[model samples]
Target: MRTLRRRMGLLVVPVLGLGLVGCCGSGERGSDASAAAAGFERAISTGDTAAVCAALAPESLSEVEESGKAECADAIPESRLPVGGSVRTVDVYGRQARVVLASDTLFLSQFTDGWKVVAAGCRLRAGHPYQCAVKGG
Candidate 1:
């Protein structure tokens, strides 16, 4: 039993390491993700409705539209998203990414065109996934 447990531990270590590496990703992907998050903040701050809606993922756009009963640009501005300040950290795994900002955290997914915000204005909750002001259903 001890030997079997040791072998299992060895197997788990490499898999876990890979997962961590994938989560951290490389500078290039991380940079892109960071840029996307920063762009969203800029658009929002500038009150550029088109750019703001363009930054959002399709599912998120749909949620805001359905819930607000208005266009993406109109609804998103009224969603009360927190001001996402400077990009602090960017983590990527496969097609998904999370950009942690000074005031907020944004979850993004890689789309055909580019990275889009799947969720934004997120705050960490103890023992739970992030609670986001902007997210799909």
Candidate 2:
């Protein structure tokens, strides 16, 4: 019985070491995602369009630019100018992520840098574009 226990311990130790290595590698990726999300949030809070654009995926940035809006910074809504509240949560997967923010409204997306207010018209969605559904009537 003692010999059997020693064998099991040896097997378990190697397996646990491998698992730790795997976790460390994955953890690095997660940290990158978190950093990206934080950068995006800071840019939005400051209403710095250039910074925001820098944080966005290239394709999304081009789309906004092609719209012929003034400047990327100018496109931000007045209400969002003085950003308030905290980031409720951030969930990242690969190149995409969702950051739930605390505000009068809910912002959502599958942003490469994390969930962002690419569109502020409506609630959050995984794949669809943002739809501003604020009730103005």
RMSD (Å) of each candidate, 1 decimal? 9.4, 16.3
- In model 2, pairs of residues that clash are 121-131, 121-132, 121-133, 122-131, 122-132
lDDT, candidate 2, 39-135, per-residue tens: 6657767767778666545444454555536545554443243342455544434333334456422222344445443322234334433333211
Specify the highest-TM-score model's number. Answer: 1
Q: List TM-scores for all candidates, in order.
A: 0.81, 0.48
Native-referenced Cα lDDT, model 2? 0.41
Residue-wise C-alpha lDDT for candidate 1, range 1-137, written one tens digit per residue: 01101131121112232235436846788888889989999998888889989999998888889878999878887788877889877778777777778998888889999999988877766544456777754
Residue 107 error for model 2, in Å? Answer: 9.5
